[model samples]
Target: MKHEFDSAFHPADIAFKTLKLAPHAWVPNNSRLPVLIYRRAVDPSTKDLGKTFEALLAGNEWLPQWRDSIFDYHHFHSTAHEALAVISGKAEVIVGGPGGEVVSVAAGDVVLLPAGTGHCLQSTEGRFQVVGAYPEGQQWDIRRDALLKEEIAAMEALPFPRSDPVAGRKGPLLQEWT
Candidate 1:
């Protein structure tokens, strides 16, 4: 089979050729500017985003590393299930539970959270490359730093993550809050 390259290429062909697979290693420019190498067009082929689920690319948005201190630490909600697929570079995916317990995720890893769960990220290496998803009617509720700090304190006060084994606790082994 021979494939021809055209300035006017179809999405299906492109997605297929790339195997629609996550990048082997998530490497981003030193500036942390995300590069949109590929994106799944919203068309008839891909319309359904099951209940409490969504899929969208987190395109590289211009942000001054020095000036943009917005994404320091926060937890947002996406009415529906949320998934972040690492395309390149190392990113720290912190999936926080009712308590302070957090599960740490690394590059080339896909982190999924139930609807209304608390999740956030702090780029540990390179630029953060991730594809985020939300339920049909869900919009990202980005919490402010002050709010996040309060939540962290609230969660820590109560022994939650440590109380339950089922609670999904992942993120950096030890994050300094002070």
Candidate 2:
């Protein structure tokens, strides 16, 4: 899956949607940042969705950080924005907080989470896998549905990632986030 980011390539070619959040419990949903969902960002039938997705994100400066063996409970990061590219299998995910929205995602899907957005794996098909990454120089901190005053403040002050994990600086992420 060699992609040439030349004249023929445009970030808008990949379709995506933005999901806004309101304060929910200790999740402290990011009032300014929205979760991004890139539907079928990659072809599910591709031979190496993980590798391709990783390369795509890295190319846009979203540093590949971990393999998506995500936990089952709801959680969020207050210090960094994150991205998850589904490589194989399908899963039901809950986003926002306890009262968040639930979405079904499968291979070739990419989900971009801003700092302070809550997410959790509700269920999954066998052999589920994903590639996770973060913006350059960003570190992540995990928090459950309980938060401190300082944590809430920090989450509110966190800056948006400089680039979209799948589409670079000019991608919809900047347009929607900024």
- Show the lowest summed lDDT stretch of 10 residues, model 1: 27-36
Error of 1 at 74 (Å): 2.4
Tens digits of per-residue lDDT, candidate 2, 1-178, equal 2122321134335667778888787777787877888877877888988888888889888998888666788899888888989998899888987778997888988888988889989899978898989888889988885778887787777766777777676667877787
Candidate 2 whole-model C-alpha lDDT, 0 to 1? 0.80
How far off is residue 39 in model 1, in Å? 21
- Residues 54-138, candidate 1, lDDT per residue (tens digit)? 2122221111111111144545442223445444445444334222223333333334343334444544666545445432333
Cα RMSD, each candidate: 16.5, 3.9
RMSD of 1: 16.5
Each candidate's TM vs. the true structure? 0.36, 0.89
Q: Give lDDT per model, in order.
A: 0.29, 0.80
- Local lDDT at 120 for model 1: 47
